[model samples]
Target: MRFTAPVDGEPVGAAITAEPLEDHFGAHSALESALMAAFDNGRNPIRSVCAESIDQNGGKGVVLHSGLFRVDGMEPDRGITA
Candidate 1:
């Protein structure tokens, strides 16, 4: 049987990936950056970086739906807080 995305609008079987392993650390990092941008510029950014992966049998799955982002465009200001 073929797999499909549980969410609507998005293409079916669309998976997401990052430069590093799709672990908690990487996923969370993606989200943090987004929030920081929202606070810094005061405009909630529209992060559209949904990612996921599969295993050998393509059964095991891991989905990444916008977490603490660690990407560019949102230079976090650790010196200050929102």
Candidate 2:
């Protein structure tokens, strides 16, 4: 996943899975900074941003919540298998 700040045209967040044993460091902080840049610290603040998570009970979900994101609802069979 990649997040960019349109106001300054800068990349704010990125996640790369290069190796199975590689740990995800600074992901939460990066995402939190991205959200803050998009929603809080700009002249043209975005009203909302939508994100989807495959595992709602996992680390991604926890990071989202830390950025004040809430679960709107779930869509059944929304993944590629559907």
Candidate 3:
């Protein structure tokens, strides 16, 4: 898959590539399984399975998009607690 960032940031509009490999597929599959389990526990999957596929590739999926867009217009200052 080909990934491109917008022109506003450093290395903007750069095309990122995900090499089709077993490792990537495995990571994606594992993430999907975890997501399904989370759903079973009454939690919603954070992203779709295909998006997760992009994640395991190299774009890191929706995270890159979220940081760039900031739908609520807020920066994540605290970072990840864990």
Candidate 4:
């Protein structure tokens, strides 16, 4: 997957992960494990996310965005999947 941070249509820092989600393991068990790892490690931090998911989750949860992140928490919104 690819993303571009634009400043008047310019690109900035980017990350490339092959089998990214495979490492991520969207499976329930894997997700839970990852959450535990990140939360317990105290390394993950809040990131710049599209406001739409924040609007949808409404503090009940948050959906991870396709931007730089260390991994904290996220939810799912139909068109706003993260």
Candidate 5:
């Protein structure tokens, strides 16, 4: 998913992911590469990017916040009900 900044009409963020592979090797690097490509494409002026995963996914959380992402906000019980 791609979203434009409301004020400037430039891309503010995008959602990207890769298919889960059983091998699990190099997945983090691959995802990072894809993100770099998106930023370096020189088309849309993206200001930020976003991704989602279950709270229990510590590895994904680490990857998301490792290079270019940070914890913004959380929607508690998102897509779930008590």
Candidate 6:
């Protein structure tokens, strides 16, 4: 995946993945996994803005938006999803 730094030009890392899930719940799991990986190993620091995209099962559609904020030992915020 392509990555861009913040306007301040600070280094940031990102991860992106795509997979099929049984339902929205499963999709949530997949997204969470990706987010965890990104924060655990990504170059971005804590509280940095991160984004995730989720695709509905069976090729229905995808919800794309940015609302996730990286924090230790906590869940990301549920931002605008399709």
lDDT of each: 0.33, 0.28, 0.30, 0.34, 0.32, 0.33
Model 1: per-residue Cα lDDT at residue 68:
27
Candidate 4 structure quality by residue, lDDT tens digits, 35-76: 444333322222233233334444333334334232333322
Q: Please give, for residues 1-82, the per-residue lDDT of candidate 3 as tens digits.
A: 2234332243322221122111222223335454334334321121233234343456433333322223232323224356
lDDT of 2 by residue, 1-82 (tens): 3334322343334222212011212223445454344333321211122223323333132122223222234321233272
Please write out the lDDT profile of model 1 over residues 1-82, one tens digit for every residue. Answer: 1224433344445333332223322333446464343333422221122222222225343443334244442222223466
Instruction: Output the better candidate (2/3) by TM-score.
Output: 3
Best by TM-score: 4
Q: Which of candidates 4 and 5 reaches a greater TM-score?
A: 4
After superposition, the stretches of candidate 5 with alpha carbons farther than 4 Å from their true spots are 1-4, 8-14, 18-29, 45-82
> What does candidate 5's lDDT look like per residue over 17-63, in tens digits?
33211111123345656544544452221222232332234213222
**lDDT (tens digit, per residue) of candidate 6 on 2-80:** 3443323444443333331212113345466654454345333223333222111222222222222323322243343
RMSD vs true structure, all candidates: 12.2, 13.3, 12.1, 12.4, 11.5, 14.5
Q: How does candidate 4 score on lDDT? A: 0.34
Give RMSD (Å) of candidate 6 vs. truth.
14.5
User: What lDDT score goes with residue 55 in model 4?
Assistant: 40
TM-score of model number 4: 0.23
In model 5, the worst 10-residue window by lDDT is 17-26
Worst 10 contiguous positions by lDDT, candidate 1: 43-52
